[model samples]
Target: MTIHELSPQRSAALTGVIPPVSTPLTPDYEVDTASLTRLVDHLLAGGVDGLFVLGSTSEVAFLPDSHRKIVLDTVTHHVAGQVPVLAGVIDMTALRVLDHARVAVEAGVDGLVATAPFYTRTHPAEIELHFRTIAAQTGLPLYAYDLPVSVHSKLGGDLLLELASDGVLAGVKDSSGDEGALRGVILGRRDRRDIASFSVLTGSELTVETALWMGADGVVPGLGNVDPHGYARLFRAASNGDWEAARAEQERLLQLFELVNVGRPRMGLGSSALGAFKAALYLRGIIDHPTTAVPQIPLNDDEIARVGKYLSASGLL
Candidate 1:
């Protein structure tokens, strides 16, 4: 049986608010260790259950290999295991992902999150082998990041459930944005046979209450990087069965989510998002610089002012 089956309690502990952390960069695009240190402390102070590094929100697609290592090492060192750190080993193929996995393992991360092989038309069986191969190579627990928009493939509930049952997957971070499909996976894991432990974490930050109410184990909200306390409160309220309070918190977060849209038309979605996240952090004085990776448009003063307004209205300022 899988380790999760052998230790069911450990699986239960995986549930809660785990935010996908944004990598704070210096003006020259280097990883700002000081800002990152502050960011981790910020999350922990907000009572986050865990930290996720090298995710889409961290601009993993734009970071080079050296920068990726810096981010993993810096975050893992700062977090110091106070809470579990799940590192994203995202790549275009299984072999490429293993390279990242090895680094994460050496960095002392608690878990690995990977996307299905992308940039090539891969068969379903290959995809299955992809996850199984990675799991076999690294003894660390594996999480499937189901981000269809980025991976160009949607992992069906049946496949994910089967993987979890067989011990190849420990959890899923569903960024697919398809509520019905995610609910299917959530409910399937509940009804599926021989699946002892699995986590269902939603990446859609806007409707966290609905996601939690539908039985998601937790959230990996990108917005959580900006206001970890808000997400934490939402999770606590939901866990306490305070749906009314949870709904109110989620509504406020929905308003905060609007900050991401402050940079549009002049930049791509990815640029806008990373820029907005760093900009918000800067406005809050959590980070010194709001520099995004190359090729991503920076938020102008006017756009950043809009982000400040969103933060103020949400009471973050």
Candidate 2:
């Protein structure tokens, strides 16, 4: 669909199984164009509704701006009308983020995933202003990405509603795993003043069914990258009001998370989660190897072994 503006309804329609897709790389750690195309095709064919380019899984922070642009262009091109491609417009500063948003616009992305600013201690008011400025510049519907554990600011529902009131952000992907906070964003305003039919996506696949049940309009999950069918099943079951089926799938996913996320540390390094996820994909024969960029530490044999064991025991291998 030749979309010029970010379509919230269109996005929701593509929501059930959106993968925070990995940035495919060659052995030497270059963007593997062929692999990326194949990966996108595989995901779409395997039942992923859409794809998220440059998310945590995509290693946006590790990639240079130019490479980020190329990655966006490649994914958007390969998506080729089969599904919407949401590009992550994450950067160090507001100006740079605006620049990235412009790149996303030029690259033909369906939407922009703008996470909270990191490194600096940004206040709630300033965070509000930052999103306002970026939204004013891009005019693309923005998906507020709130992974407080990874970013600069801790988001509350009040801040999200404030931004939505200004038409600055269209929706949120609350990776914070705080159900109450997510609920606030969803039920913050009923007047539909600024943005009518606002959206909120849950980034926590482990609790995505719960989030959706709690009023999340969409879900953008990392685990969906590895197991799109499973996530899709969960989303469909939830939407169909099949509580029993949804609960069953959720239990299965929780079991998987317990295995993969066991003993995983919370660090700002950006490599830990990505490494494990890539290794999981590798073990599943989805990728060749898990090659992180410079300054990003590669998972040692022990860590890989843990991930391997997790997958094998879960019967994913």
TM-scores, one per candidate: 0.96, 0.87
Worst ten-residue run, lDDT, model 1? 1-10
- Residue 299 in candidate 1 has what lDDT? 94
In model 2, what lDDT does residue 93 have? Answer: 68
The CA lDDT of each predicted structure is: 0.89, 0.75
Q: Judged by lDDT against the true structure, how good is candidate 1?
A: 0.89
lDDT of 2 by residue, 62-176 (tens): 8888789889989988788788788899976688787788888899887788877778888777777777777766757787888877784767788787777666666777788
Clashes of 2: 0
Please report the TM-score between candidate 2 and the true structure.
Answer: 0.87
